[model samples]
Target: MSKDPEDRLTVGEVSRRTGVAISALHYYESLGLIASERTTGNQRRYPRYMLRRISLILVAKRLGISLTEVQHVFDTLPLDKLPTAHDWRRLSRLWHTQLEAKKREIEQLERELMGCIGCGCLSMKSCRLLNVDDELAELGPGPRRLDAAQAA
Candidate 1:
């Protein structure tokens, strides 16, 4: 379909253009990661640029960033206007810090895994190193931590 310069996109159209499922678009909207306007018929219509926003969100998620963190990053932008190239460059610069931190974390995990494997210290108490517990303690409370049963 030929799109008019001023025409807004239906959710389905946005999905088709972005290659994201319509339900996911709705979820993104609900999460305030994207936005839309309601038509007279109560149908959701989005600005054309939301396609790019969705693409950015997908990329950020793939990088293991949470939606909340992505929303915080988006908060740096002017909500009423589409982002300019300078805005994208500034945002990309912020991402480098995150990328570096992830790289370091991965490197540490690699060393820990290698040490554990080499020493045959898969069990917690008998291990000479404390890599697994240390990382879990840093993470606080999460599924990454050993459950009580597993800890025993």
Candidate 2:
């Protein structure tokens, strides 16, 4: 919010402003999702712009996006300034397809979960009535029946 491009915030100030813990900020830095400069006294100081990145990370987290994915998208963003509305739009567009696929996967799993509730045994050998001598194994690992159902 400061007009000064040199405006910087201490870790505690950033934490208070963003409602993020200082440790989490450090973790984000460690993961390369965010960065900071060290003072001569060895304290971390973040540019005011990093608040936007942290906010974006929190939103992505709530949407079930991984930090790796966030970092991938963030690689395209400018680090010296707050991301514009257009930048945020682009980020959302990038994530839209991934989120949709994840939604469909969750829906399919929910449907299959109901079907499995009675048997509850997803074992290849024990679920002979459904798996029938592990024939599904030939297709590879995971819930082959569920995956097959989805394919259908």
Per-candidate TM-score against the hidden true structure: 0.76, 0.74
lDDT of 1 by residue, 61-93 (tens): 887778888889998876545667887788677
The 10-residue segment of model 2 with minimum total lDDT is 124-133
Residue 30's lDDT within candidate 2 is 92
Clashes of 1: 0
Candidate 1, residue 84: the lDDT equals 78
What is the TM-score (0 to 1) of candidate 2?
A: 0.74
Candidate 2 clashing pairs, residues 3+ apart or interchain: none
lDDT of 2: 0.84
Best model number under TM-score: 1
Candidate 1: regions farther than 4 A off: 1-5, 123-152
